[model samples]
Target chain A: MQKWADNRAWFLILPVFLVVAFSAIIPLMTVVNYSVQDILGPGMSVFVGSEWYKEVLHNPRLHDALFRQLTFSFCVLAIEIPLGVGVALTLPRKKGVWASTCLVLLALPLLIPWNVVGTIWVMFSRPDIGLAGVTLNEIFHFPYNYTADPLHSWLTVLVMDVWHWTPLIVLLGYAGLQAIPEAYYQAAKIDGASRFAVFRYIQLPKMRGVLLIALLLRFMDSFMIYTEPFVLTGGGPGNSTTFLSQFLTRLAVGQFDVGPAAAFSLIYFLIVLLFCFVFYTTIVNLGKGEAQ
Target chain B: MRMKKRTVALLCYLIFLLLPIYWLVNMSFKTTDEILSVFNLLPENFTWANYAMIFTDPSWYTGYINSMKYVALNTIISLTVALPAAYGFSRYNFLGDKHMFFWLLTNKMAPPAVFLLPFFNFYQTVGLFDTSIAVALAHCLFNVPLAVWILEGFMSGVPKEIDETAFIDGYSFPRFFTTIFIPLIRAGIGVTAFFCFMFSWVELLLARTLTAVNAKPIAATMTRTVSASGMDWGGLAAAGVLTMIPGAIVIWFVRNYMAKGFALGRV
Candidate 1:
């Protein structure tokens, strides 16, 4: 794609600039203002600079939720990525109706509303009524109650997330797989490459761009997961499933602690930025150090 | 042996995928009383009372209408703003192109939780609270960047010669874009619209925050379940099932573009 050096192209970007500015900048400035002020009430606020930030930084609950959030994100990335790549590999490779059938079926869960995903899981995992709960209790003879046991609650959230979102990775991975031309595979076959060898050398390398997209998207989405977990666990049987977003929501909405919430949010933003920076740098290093 | 193993893996995955969905359907069929009273694989007494309640009750069904209104508005606004920005970004090297692009992506990266409070206050002050336009504009914080990225990718794929030739033929910029450029990237537009629709439709937090009653989203409406009767479990399940329909239909319509789009501009 050739790009002309035209400073006047700035004119074309004006609408997007105005819209995003109105939506993002004002609210962000509001957050920053609240972060440094003690909003006593409507039209009454004290300038309490850095007070909220310090308190939020030291809060034990924040630490707990941060740990839980990180663990959940790590688990999601670990499970979804490889599984998505593998599922993409396994999808019956062809075109037309059969292929689209597979794609649509896999994508169904991804398209459903997050709240509905939560609600469906809630209905499906009810101890006395749910198929899962019933099977675990009756057939498997394992006592499973998401609302009572912390472990059960955590596992249920993880399982629900995997159920709802793994298909997104799969679809992305499948697209990446589809983009690989036939010539490469044919060449691999001619060289007597085994299935694993061909995948390792050809498919993995070719899928890097889409895989990176999948990784970054999955990281951000999973990190900020709110509606599903909020609906499913209500942030817990005991705050076990309460991630950073849930904690932030609790601070801002439930407690109305605007200053702390805002400061906490800034930290949350920084942490996300930090993780993205790390991921980007590592990927860059990998690109520089190795051909693949 | 290889064939057997492959078939087994695929079947296992499919079963894992569909089981919870099947359970939700099973729940939708049963009455709330039956669901609580019995532990059964299939609904012993099937009922459409839940669905009937939704259709009969305007308050319940209006949530769907309100949601569609805002989502449609958001998608249209997102595409309109993103179109020219995408063209500009794709075709021209501006003074701060990289910085501008980064800023857009950063907004997309910003969590909605951070914006909920400020948005609530801002919308209230602006008198846009509980209106479809407010929520639609709020959604642009994220959707605009995504729309631009998707459209830019597609636009870059189109040859620059088309733009040059159209200009040489004495066509104005707006005319060439509307008639020629847009049609060429129609798939990109469809894909972008589908995404904008999905994200807006599914997001409850910001939508819930921005609206109280008149513009309430279906997802938010579903959560307002503590009525005179306890939880209304059957009704909730039925509503959840209904909510899945629109998204399913949209994906089915755009399944082809989705396959192409996912590899490119998709998150």
Candidate 2:
């Protein structure tokens, strides 16, 4: 794992730098530019200088979207992490036909196009024709309509997300579980360790690295979720499922409120960056601790 | 008892995962009228009309071609750039290397929605709008970083001695990388390419925003089915089923490596 001290390696990274910067930096600069100016026309713009920031900071809509986004991400991480690990535990360890089949099926949802996932769920959960919807309404005698009911819409989006993405967690958890040495289990058995004790001591500790990656990946992706919910609920049942990304798109692309939307974009970027910083540092420290 | 419980749990979760997909396939076979009126578990009157429509229609089939174009471009660009960058990170500790690696990763966290306005304007200014390349470049914002991360994991798995030995055998850097280093990590490259293709293929917001009439992705094209004439449930279901085909095929080839690849090879 020892690496040579070679600054010339920067040359090797130059291509990636150019590509990512072309995609990320120039647009970011434009967002920053738009945030400061109020455009009257194509070239006729005034330097508004923090007016948009002030308005966006106090905006109630932004507040609501941020709150909703937080709750959604929290629920995603809470449900997915444990469920993924639990399902992963049930997977067959020895490689064979069943194990391979289980893996392929588990990975199918993760590969589906995001909007298709939304569309599939729309058909699968519709009250009129959807299996879940009809079962709830006719079979179980419960009122379930994602289109007309706010609570139903929210639940639909949440469950849809769980179905679409929980496989990622399961895959990561299964990989982590696979990496644990057989000696650890043998040692646990020799020590007369209970199943709970073995899992707590051996499996959990060993899986920390991958579980952390899963946590951060799930958190960031769920925080930025737009496509599925946008397709499914269209940010409705009267804005119940509208999250931060959809809100920003509405302001910027839908309404052309460039100044406020640009400021809001900056704020949104910073919030994600803040969380990334926390997770990044933790991962780095974990590596360092392991090295020592 | 424990084996029975485990099998039951796995079966339940797998069933939960497959049911929606089954619904999509089932609906694809029924007529739109049948989808609305009948609540049958299976297609009452199975037909190939929906699949036929997709294959016969220019608008429907071109979307798939366009999607494939951009996804291919994005995967090639991502892997080409990420290869050396990943090698650099895996092999050397340069100035700002750690910081640069983390910085590259931060791009993966930037929400695509935030980039919509700026990208729309920026691409239009450069006249790259409505092109598959535009979508490909925009997707690089996320895909490149991920490729670098995953490829780094795989590259680091190869020992430093290989590089040194290759050099001692009178090989130039490029020759060594392509002939010696590449074939050694070809599996890693395949996995990285799969991740790149998967991420770029599944994305909608940027792909939809970047293209218009000429190079529209199938995912974007599928949106047109929701016209005022009510939904084309059968056709839409067929298109949805089609979108999953490429992923399913690619995942099958890489089935053994799925977990390790998802872990970015770190595990």
Candidate 2 structure, TM-score to reference: 0.99
Q: Model 1 residue B133 lDDT?
A: 100
Per-residue lDDT tens digits for candidate 1, residues B1-267, read 876676577668878998988888887888999988888788888888989999999989999999999999999999999999999998999899977987897787888999999999999999999999999999999999888977887888888998999999999999999999999999999999998998888888999999998999888888877324546788888888899899989999999889667755532
What's each prediction's TM-score? 0.96, 0.99
Best by DockQ: 2
Q: How many residue pairs clash per model?
A: 0, 0
The models' CA-based lDDT, in order, is: 0.87, 0.93
Clashing pairs in 2: none
lDDT (tens digit, per residue) of candidate 1 on A1-292: 5578999999999999999999999999999999999988888999999999999999999999999998999999898888888877777767878678878888899878888898888888878878888888888989899999988999899999888888888888887777778999899889999989988998898778678877877898899999888888888889899999999999999999999999998889878777766665565465455544
Q: What is residue A199's positional error in candidate 2, in angstroms? A: 1.2
Docking class of 1: medium
Residue A161, model 1: Cα distance from true site in angstroms: 0.9
By summed lDDT, the worst window of 10 consecutive residues in model 2 chain A runs over A283-292
